[model samples]
Target: MMRVLAIGDIHGGLKALVQLLNKLEIKDGDTLIFMGDYVDGWSESAQVIQFLIELSEKINCIFIKGNHDVWCEEWLRDGSVDMTWYIHGGKETMESYSGFSKEDKQKHLAFFENLKMYHLDNKNRLFLHAGFTSMHGVEKEVFQTTLYFDRTLWEMALTMDKSIERDSELFPKRLTHYHEIYIGHTPTTNFGVEKPMNATNVWNVDTGAAFKGKLTAMDVETKSFWQSDNLPCLYPNEKGRNKD
Candidate 1:
């Protein structure tokens, strides 16, 4: 069977991504969904993007755009620099590409510029880099950017009031739109969760590869998961946004 595999934020941990992909033993026919943040935090941002581009040639790939990716596109394509991005790991991403040629850089720019904000499958499952405010579907252009930044959707799941009727207006539409929702912007480590977490049918797969933690990949059908070791261990000499 061609199982759907969803991966968390990579943050440019090429080694970790490789290790997790090995564990998944992914086949050419399988569909793979990556939750973005592919550049930044780690020291191999350029390598990570290169590997992903190659992998897309072998299997079906769905790439979601993260906030960090937005920062990357701005800097790489428009030569725009925002201090906010620099404060968050953009420096490392730039460093990773410092030696690449203009042609090499353009390839990566094309990849990021074409990333999707949200994706829905025939199974009625939704996948995005962050939260969404509308339940009607991704087509309801209600502050569409929320699909890449909103956290209230996950927060509500973590704090669901079971007393409220599901059919009532008081119920959050964000939680009822799809049969399942997968996201990756908010790190699971922030909530002390070290693995893929499912709350109110929303699955948070970002196990914090950007920080001093592991990278996660999950089978959306079987819920089976694979992970890499603490990424700091994977790259001893390079700092991966875990300066603290």
Candidate 2:
């Protein structure tokens, strides 16, 4: 069977991420799928991206764009988006690369732009940065925006009525076409916490690593999971509280 590792939101916790990856004991053929939120929150965004770039050279790595990643792209393309991004822990990401040159920043921006919205593996599983709703079609989907910042879709999916057929053409049911979906963005309990829940075939793995909660990882094929100890939060008030 293929060994697939589904990791939760990193939120710039490079140290913890490295530790978790080490603990998993990744092998040559193993696939490492990062759910989203790779940067912002902790002070290692640059390091995290660099590490992923290096890892990409060795293994099959899938990086999906998270909301913060989208913000980063916006800030890079147009500086006007900095205010919103800064409020959402973008300051930390910026601070992480204080020493990098303009060229280095541009390189990272290109990497962010290249992130995928979703990954389909042999029709059995799907990996997305954030959950998708029926309102979104595959053709119109934008990885930087829809996959990362669409909270309206998330809420609709979360509060969906169970009595209705999940396969309906409206709401998040459109996602049912895929066997299983692994997503990040909405924290399970709160920031830094990890909870695994199954809605139809959708699986949420955000686990909130930015808010002093644990970073989570799951073996999709084996149904095994791993989590780090609670790490400290960068912005205690915002990251500590649950938005939902």
* C-alpha TM-scores of all predictions: 0.95, 0.83
Error of 1 at 36 (Å): 1.3
- 1-244: candidate 2 lDDT, tens digit per residue: 5589899988887877877887888887888898878888777878888888888988889888888888777776666566877877788777778888888778888888898887888856878887554534443565445666665555655677777676565536456566777888887864233566656566777776877577888999877888876656433334422233
- Model 1's C-alpha root-mean-square deviation from the true structure amounts to 1.5
Query: Candidate 1: what lDDT?
Result: 0.88
Please tell me which predicted candidate would have the highest lDDT against the true structure.
1
Predicted candidate 2: what Cα RMSD to the true structure?
A: 3.8
Distance from true location, Cα of 71 in model 1, Å: 0.8
How well does candidate 1 score on lDDT at residue 199? 81
* Model 1 lDDT, residue 84, Cα: 87
Provide the clashing-pair count of each candidate structure.
Answer: 0, 4
Model 1's number of clashes is 0
lDDT of 1 by residue, 1-244 (tens): 8889999999989999999999889876799999979988888999999999999988899999998898999898878988988978888888889789999989999999999998999999989988876667666848867878888888988888768766789877766678888999899999998899988788999999999879999999999999999899998987788766
